[model samples]
Structure formats: structure tokens, C-alpha cells
Target: MRLTMLTFGLFAGPAFAQPGPPAEGPDEIVVTGQKRDGTLQDADASITVLDAEAIDQARLRDFRQLDDLVPNVQFNEAGQLSNVFITIRGVESNPFIVNRAAVYIDGIPFRELTNAVLSQVESIEVLRGPQGTLYGANSESGLIVIRTRAPSRDAEGEVRVTGSLFSGTGGAGIEAYYSTPLVSDTLAASLAVKYGREATWMRNRAAGVTEPGEIEERFVHGRLRWTPSDRTTLNATAYLLDINAPGLFDNDFFPQDRTLYDQLYGALNGGRPSGRYGYFHDAPKRTDETEYVLGLSVAHEVGSGTVDAAVSYRRDRSDSLGLDFDFTSLPTAAGRDDNDQRVTNAELRYASAQQQPLSFLAGVAYFRDDKDNQKSTFVGPGDLDSYVAAPVQTRSIESLSGFGSLRWRPAFVRDVTLSAGLRYDHTRQRAVQREGQLDLGGGSILYYTDARLASTDDAWLPRFSITWEPTDDATFFGTIARGYIPGGFNLAATQENITDPDVLRYRSETMWSYEIGFRVRSADGRFRASGAVFQIDSNNWQEIRVLTDETGRPVSSDFIGSSASIRSRGFEVEASWRAVPGFDLSASFGYADATYLYLFNGIEDLAGNRVKLVPEYDANLSARYQHRSGVFARAAMNFVGAMALDERSYAVQPATTMIDLQLGYENERFTARLFVDNLTNVRRFSGLGFDNLAFGTDGTVYGALEAPRIVGAEVEMRF
Candidate 1:
């Protein structure tokens, strides 16, 4: 038996939805964050658990919207349809880097972070630390695990509609879910669908167009569950995502003084800097993407243990069109990218029953991914036909891993437990790139040579933990773990005119982490709190360095590199109190100090610099009230500290805060809510992007803005 967190039956907004009040004071919760089932308070890890009610109350539609809720977790999208960057505990990676944090949906891994939509999710677990022991490479920083709603024995259904308006633009969303039994207690099925559309606020002055930021999205999910006997069960799920967004508008910014802008552009582009943030040339911002996933899982009881198996396949495709170096209406610069990816994975696991003094588990997994990319750029002045460079690239990856864990409870130590885990992983990656024939403005074509490369890596990750419960209401734990990320060849290494061999491959990165944490609940179960402190020493930290020419000027070469060492230390605290019967308060605060210990790019010393995009401080506070009258309200705010946008600390984005409010009424059959996000209308940049080829300047930065103030209402019906 384990201690569980208490859940009050209250609907604050979206994140707070439950069937009904429990006969007890609060509902108990169970979590499976460590590949084993246990109460959250008993897990020896730093984790944030978002139950279905919490998720809905927060109105978190995507992972990006979940940033400030957890400590030391950051999410930023580059405004490209599917390119998203995530940093956990100051461990971050480049956009094109394949090795980083890992995202899992129902035990199936996904390459794209944005694909983890929240439409049909039952719960989300953010395990914030090195998870390499069980998850293997690329999970060196952390892991995001999503569990979708499972089929129930009885028929159930829900429908929700929401709409919002902000800055002269409006958005709407619709979602529906249904579940029913097919064969009484033996089989069941569930289906869910979601659609959303939003209008962009940025208006292009030069293009004489407004609402260029419009975007539409659709998602579908289906699942089936079959239980032939009490000891055997099988589940299958399928998901689809489709999105479209057209034209670029108000994504860039320039100097209000035309003279200064012109001079700067002239210095960078030989005539004038061609692009402005708010106004662009003839090009419209555009994005179109489609993704599909299918997965199956089976479990059976064998003697004193259980055997589990899972298999999955996924495919993703995207096409985009936008302006090139100059943001103007002229055909001078244009760019396009078409990308496709396919992935297949399989896993098998066996776990001993936890009722004994000793429990053990073992697993094996394999996955393969293949990708094809077609990227093109057209550069010429005011003509439809100009210098065009189109490159086609193909990449393939195969990974195999085996892992095991053991837990022991000694008879002498009445309430003490020791656990250990180890995992071995082997990965092989290969890529081929061919430069398209250059269509020189004239009637001639120049063909370029092709580039091919391959890399293979192996690593062993280990973990050890000890947990002690001195009293029924308090527990203490400590953990030490090792994490790894494999090395691989760069896709652009074989492109034309790249002379630096160092750009071809980067070495594997490893980290050793140490952590201590505690969880406690009040005697009356009215108050709960958890806290953890951790430090990590990272070696061979993968870094993307900007290539420079002899004159120390920036060049078009960006390659994978490594820093000698980097260190990150952080602490987090989360607490919740049920002050009174219908009132609740919760707060979370985190502080981190991450710095480059020893870094040299062959040109300069970057030691002592702060990691890019990792804020030093993050905090959140929330309060909710629910009455027996079926009335509820909540107010919450999140804060993020200042952070540097680049390695050199050349540019910095300031700290910002966001406030949200919600009010709703709920009963047995129906509920309605009104919400306001970004209550203060604070518009800030979520992240910075670098494109030397487009700006022709080394330090130039572009970024996407956070959404402005939004007011919306939602109605949900359940039957």
C-alpha cells in the first residue's frame, strides 16, 4: 500500500473536472511514472502530475501551454508547423538535433514534440530528471508521458465547444468523445475528435492583407479494448492530426526609422535589409502538416508476474512556403521545405508482483525511423526565375535497448526500500544528401556532388535509489542516475561547399545526476507538499557552434560540436492546501543555476555563460473556490525569469508574467465556463531563432510572440 495525493471534487475551469465528490474527504490517485504502478507520493523521482481535471482547468491545449505550470520546464515553438523546442532542468538541444528530451504517448515514443496533443488525454506525467536508466538515450534531460482515457464498461459520451476573441481576431474549438461496451464486460471501444481554428492578429502593411496568421487544425483518436479472460487483455489505438496555416504576416520587426533600417539593410544585404517583422513582400506565411499513429498493447498474467507487449507505427508529413532572405513582396527570395518521416517501434516487458518483499522487472525494445526532406531556396532580384538551390536528403535510424530493475525491502528496515535499474542501448544512424542542379538565371545548370555518412553508438545507463518512510504521512528519498544521448551525422554535412570535417558528426553526451526529495501530507489530509534538490554534471555536451571565416566573420557553416563540461543545479517546491471545505490554494517555485563550465569553439572561451533559453527562475500560484451551489472560480498566474537567447549572451529576452482567470458552473449533466488568458495582455517572445543565410548577419534574431489577451466561453455536455 502507498500514500496518495488527495483530489477534491471541484471544477475551477478546465484542469478541474471530476465525476462527483467522493465519500471520503478527497479522491486518491495512482501514478505509473517509473514503469511501475505506485502512488505519486511514494515515487523516488521529481515529477509533476496533471490529472484530467487539472489539465482541463488550465486550458492547456498543447505542451507549449504547459510551460509555467512545472518547474524548470520550457517549451517554445519556432513558428514552423511542427518544429518545437523543449528544455528540462537547463538541458536543451538544437532544433535539428535528434537527441534530446523524449515524448511518449501510451508507451509509444514520438519524434515530434508538438504531436502530443491534449484532446483525449487522461493524464500527463512530467518526469523532470535524467530518465536514461529505463528510457535510454535522448531522454537524458527528462520525459513526457501521456496516458489517454481507457475504455469503460458502461456507455459514456461528452461534447464541448469553445470560442475566443483577441486583438480583432477570433478563434473557435470543438471536441467530442464517446465510449461504449461492445460485448458487455469483454470488449469496449472509444472514439474522440477535435477541431480548432484561429485568426492571426499580425497585419501586413505592405501586402495590404490582414489576418495572415490564420490556422486550422483537426485531430481524431480511436481505441479498442478486449479482455478474453481475467488474466488477459489487449488494447489498440489510432490517432490522426491535420493542420494548415497560410502566409507570413507580422512575424518580423524592424527599426521605426526608415533611414536607420535602410542603412542596416544596405550594410547586410548590399542594398537594404529586405525584411521587416510586421510587413513582408509578396510571400504569405504558410504551413501544412499531416500525421498518423497506430499502436497496440497486450498484457497477460503468468504465475506471480505479468507479461506486457506493445507495438506502434507512426508517419508524419509537412509542406511549407514562405519568404527567403528579404521579407519583401519581390520574388527576390523564397523558400520551401517538404519533409516526411516514418517510424515503427516494438517492446516487451515482464514484471513480478509487488506484494512480495522483492520485486523485479525487465524489458526489451526496438525502433526504426526513416525520413526524407526536400529543401529549396530561390535567390534573385525581382524576377520569377533566379538562382535556385534545391537539396534532397534522406536519413534513417535504428535503435535497440534492454533494461531491468529490482526493488528490495529488507526485513530489518521496517519501512525502507532500495531499488536499482540499468539499461543498455545501441543505435545506428545514416544520412545521404544530394544537391540539386543549380538553375543559373541563364540557360545553364551546374550539378553538385552527393554526400553520404553514417555513425553508430552504444551506452550503458544505471540508476540507484533509496526510500524511507519514518511515519505514515512523510517519506524521504534519494537517487543517483546516469543519462546518455547518442552521436549522429548531420544532415547538412554533405551539402555543397562545406569544407569543415568537424561538421559531419558530433560525439555522444553523458550526464551524472544526484537528487534528494521528500513528500509529506498533513494528519488531516488537508495539506500536501513535495520538494526536491538536484545537481547534474554533464560531459561532452552537444553544442551547435557558428562557423567563422579567417576574419572572425560569421559564415554559412553551422555544425555539431561539443563543450568540455556543463553543470546544472536546481531545486523545486510544490505545495497545496485545502484551507477550508470549498477553497483550495496551490503554489510551485523553482530556481536553477546552469552554466558552461568549460567551452571553447576553437575561437573563443564560452565558459561561465548561461545556457540559452533556460530561465533561472519559474513560479506559479493559483487559487480556486467551489460551492455546493455548483458555482466555481479560479485565478492563476505564472512567472518566468530573464534568459539569454544565444550562447554569447549577445541578446536577452526579459522576464514576463501571465495571468489567467476562469469561472464556471457544473452539475451532473452539463457545465459552462468563461475564461480569460493573458489577462494583462502581455505580449512577449517565447524564443529566438537564427538564420544566417536569410539575414546575412551572424547575431540577427527572429522569434514568435506569445498569444495576447483572450476571452472565451465553453460549454460541455456529458451523458
Candidate 2:
């Protein structure tokens, strides 16, 4: 047993508790990550804040449990619950297009991350880099803002329960929430609910089906608030989600020497006989999903300046069933996929006032999306030994934007400050495609068509900043930015290789960023520090591949037609210390290189490599303790470094460390907790798929594992 990596450390392990002040002195942390709302050391970018008691003391239920505790966030989403892939600082994009990092709730904008939900979240702000002058076109790898939970002026309620111990892959959960005040101080309301289920340890050696990967979920929420005077306010929200999982090539495969439970019963009937071998399957994979959301917000304070508005509507539906494509148990092949989506949004803003040397902010935005997608495959099942493969698509998108920002304060230096921002965006798109193959009684061997392909794109984003505050706990900052991503239409397969529908439309991705930072607070704030250095450069950059047909079967895949260049550089450090009085300590460290400059795809050149799941170093350490007869304890550790999931494979995903422990008892209305997550049982491997990486006898190596070892217990009540 041996494994140790720990790239950068600040006294080793733990994080998520560093906003400072308390233990009877100092205090700060009231942030919005700059859409105006201040105080995270007066915000100058490079932020990360997770409140709500640090998300219930790290029970962080989403976003991959907030990996590395927010130090250059990274992901690959093993056994995906809905196609997840995100990277920040290493800015990733194209996991079948769209999403270059952007998520917001309470300010709309969502298109993935399974529709972003974290129960009744009350705070979460992560704005790492390239926020494109106040968000535009996916913000080019940066931004995740959430704020929920508001509505309580008198009554309140809560309830919770959780259990897991992994005895035959265990899991369980339950939740509830409530709030009130309906016209007391001028209205308020809230409600929430949740449920969960899990169990799956992978066992299905040719239909034996022991645990076969399982998951289930459900959630619901609602809110409303109004305050007709004292400068007006209004808000409303709604949500719903349901999910079921197990797919992403249903796990259990490991070659390079048996020992995945003895190669799953020796590949269930041992090797070749028309491709029916290993991890032993018989075609069955699943997924089903549903989502919906609605929102509205308004604010006013006209005299001293402030006005805001927002609106949203969304819907999503998905289904993917049994896709053993060719993991071999000889059903020959199988597939089914579907998607439907809709969205609408709007925003408006204005801000000014703050005495003295000029200040301003202005904004406008609108967006719309509609989509439908389908994919199907089946081979040999009826009438003349049937085979059918279908592909369908329909899409539309529209967007418009306007933005502004300006600020300056000068009376001969005296604590300098300057800022600038600009944004202009326009987009329009429409695409419809159909590619087919069928033979149910011998008919229509193949066909392809793409009609109504239209496109339009425009952009101009910019930002600049400088700040220096020589006192009140010090600060220094600098920044420069520009970012964008837009371009689409690609869905063609069947030995596809540029069958020119105008080259299948793909282009648009750009970035440029630079930063410098510093922050400090220790004049009785019990010590706090921050640091940053950054650089980013990108161009074009998009990816997708899979094509075959010539005695190796499997035909069709697309997306790639010139343009690739990338670069990333990073440095970050964060700290907190309270020492004594109720005890607390925190730490963070990060580093990134994220290579690739002039990457190739016309037969692999891969310029300088690196940059597939993005990781070059990340660290976190945490410690906390409290007593006064309430009792508490916590310990944490995190690390990730080593990633490459393909771009001309070498299959990597090592460098891991995760340790967590928690114990509790609280008062102000009872609570209890006990947790242990991946404490040590690390079997490693968290996603990799090459869609049969050029099938050379090793085809079908599909893998996903890691999430074994959980022991949880929770209980709560409040009123």
C-alpha cells in the first residue's frame, strides 16, 4: 500500500471556513461576487465563499461535493448523473458543446450541472476568472452564483435525516423546510422538500445482477417575498427535479491484470464468440430525468440609486435507456437517447450613488433557447434481421445584451480606485438535422440531410480594474479580461468525415485574462490572508471525435475543423486562523499549468498535451472545533493533481487524496451529525471513455469507479 502526492500545501489538508472574524472579534463576508453587494475583503475577484454554516459543515450535496474545496475547481463526473464536465482556470468546454462555465440561480442562467440545486442554499459564490465584463456567453469558464433561502420574519421550520453505511451499497435521505410571514412586514413564504436513494456496487456478470449501479432522487422548492415599501422589493421562485441513474456505459471493466472481483467472474463465459466478453453484460443501462424552474425578482431604491429586475423560466427532459453499445454480452448493439429543453430569461439593472468621484453601472439582457435531440440504435431484432440507427435534432437560440460599468475615485491618489467594463453581444441560431438508417424488411439503407442551418454571432467584451486601499486591513488588485464562446450545429454520423453541410458549423471560443491580487486582514480579525496570480489565453478550442466503419463497425461522430490553442497559468493561496477561543484553522493552495498550444486533430499532434480534466495541483486543509457545551469537531483534507482523460489517450486520473471526518451536536434547536466520506477506501478511477478508442482489440475499456466508503448519519430539527 503506497500513494502520496500532495503537490502544494499550507501545512497540509482542509478548507472551507475562511472568511474571518468571530471568536468574539472582527467579522466580514457578505458577498455577491461583484454584481454589486460587497464585503469579501471588498471584493476584487478570485472569490470563493460558501456559507449557510459552510454548507451545513461540509455536507455539500452537489457540484461533486465541491471538489478541492474550491481551488481551481475540476471535474469529470464519473458515472455521470447527467453529463457533467467543468474546469475553471483551465477553462474547459465542449463535452458536446455549450457551457464554458456559468451557473446562477436567483439571477437565472443554467444549462447543465444537472440544473444546479443545493437544497435551500443561502450563499455560494465562486468567480474565479474571465467573467467577461459582468457575464456574457458562458462567461468563458467562471461564475457560479447562488443565493437562496430568504423569507422568514417570524415562523420557521426544518427537518432532516440521512443514513448510509455501505452494507451492500447503502443509502437513504429525507428533508424538509418551511418559512413564514404572510403580510406581517409585508409578505414572505417558503417551502422545500427532498428525497434520495442509492445503492450500486456493480455486479452483473452476464445477467446475475447483484447491485448494478443505482440512484434515485427528487427535490422541490418554492418561495415568495414582497415588501411594498421602505424602498420596494419582490421575489418569487419555484423548482422541481427528479432523476434516476445508471449509465455512462454501466461500469465494471479493468484490464491490465485481473482483480476487479476476479475480472467479474472471468468475463462471464470467457472471451470471443462474436464479441461477448468482459465486465460481462447483456445490454441494459438507464437514465431518466426531469427538471423545471421559474423565477422573478425586483428591487427598488430610487433616491440614492438602485434598481434591479430579473425573470426566468426553464424546462428540461431527458431519457437514455439501455446503451450497451458494444460492451459485449452480444445483444450485438443497443442505444436510445433523447433530450428536450426550453428556456427564457431577462434582466435589467442600474446602480449609482456612493458619493464622490463618479460611479455607474447599467445592464440589459435577454436570452431564449429551445431544443430537441434524439439518437437511436438497434441491430438485429425482427423482420429480415432488423437494424435501425436514427439521429434527429432541432434547435434555436437567441440572445441580446448590453452592459456598462465605470468607477473612479481620485483626488490626487489617496487610495486609488479605477474600473471599466463593456459588453455587447448578439446571437441567433437555428439548426435542424436528420441522419438515418433502417432496414425493417429491407428498406432505406442510409440517408443524411441537414436543412435549415442558420447562424449569427457577435461579441465584444472587456474589463479593466485597479484598486489599492492602503488601510482598513489592506488590499491591492489588478485585472484585465475578455471572454466569449458561441458557435454550433453539428450532429452527423455514419462514418462521418466532413460530409460538408457547410463543414457542420463549429467555431467561436476566445479568451484573454490577466490578474494580480492581494488581501489581508489581521488587525484583530484573528488573521486572514489571500493571494492570486493568473493568466489565461485561449482560441477556438472545441472537441468531439469518434468515427469508424471498415470492419471495425461503429460509424459516425463529429466536431473538429481547425482551431485550437490554449494556455493557463495559476497561483492562489488562502488562509485563516483563529487559534484559541473556540479554535479554527483553514488553508488552501492551488497551481495549474494547463498546456496545449496549437493542438491537432487531423490525426493527432496534441501540441504540448495536458488539459483534459485539468489538474496540476490543488490542496485544502481544514480544522474546526467549538465548545460551550454544544460540542463540535471537524477535520478535512483534499488534493487532486493528475488528469488526462483523452485527447489521444494515455488514460490518466490519479493523484487523489480525500479525507473527511465530522462529529457534532448543536443547539438553538437540536441537530446531530456524523460523517466519513472516502476516508481511505479509495479504489480510484473516476471516468474515462474513448468510445472504443480506435478499437484495436482493447476496444471497450469503459470505466468508472470511486465512491465507495461513506458512513453518514444526520438528524436535525428546528422550529
Candidates' lDDT values, in order?
0.71, 0.66
User: Could you give candidate 2's per-residue lDDT for residues 1-719 as a string of tens digits?
Assistant: 00000000010000011233443445777666467645777667778777888877776765566655778777555453545557887776535566688876656777455523255576778888878677788878788776666777788988887777653457777878898998888887777777777654444455533336566777777777777776767777776777777632422333322343234434433542211122555555666677777777677778777777777788878776555544445455555667888888887878776464778878888899898877665553322113244666788888898988888888899887888889888989887776555321112133555556788999999888888889878788888888878777665532244457545777877788888988888888877888788999888777665454444333544555436778899887878788988778888888888888877765677888887777788788988897978888888898877777666556666788888888998899988978887788665555544444123234333555555567878888888
Clashing pairs in 2: 13-621, 14-620, 14-621, 14-622, 15-621, 183-187, 494-556
What are the per-model C-alpha RMSD values against the true structure?
6.0, 22.7
Q: How does model 2 score by TM-score?
A: 0.34
Tell me the TM-score of model 1: 0.89
**Which candidate achieves the best TM-score against the true structure?**
1
- Model 2, C-alpha of 560: deviation from truth (Å): 23
Model 1 poorest 10 in a row by lDDT: 1-10
Report the Cα lDDT for residue 552, model 1.
38
- Per-residue lDDT of model 1, residues 531-560, tens digit only: 999898999888776654453333433366
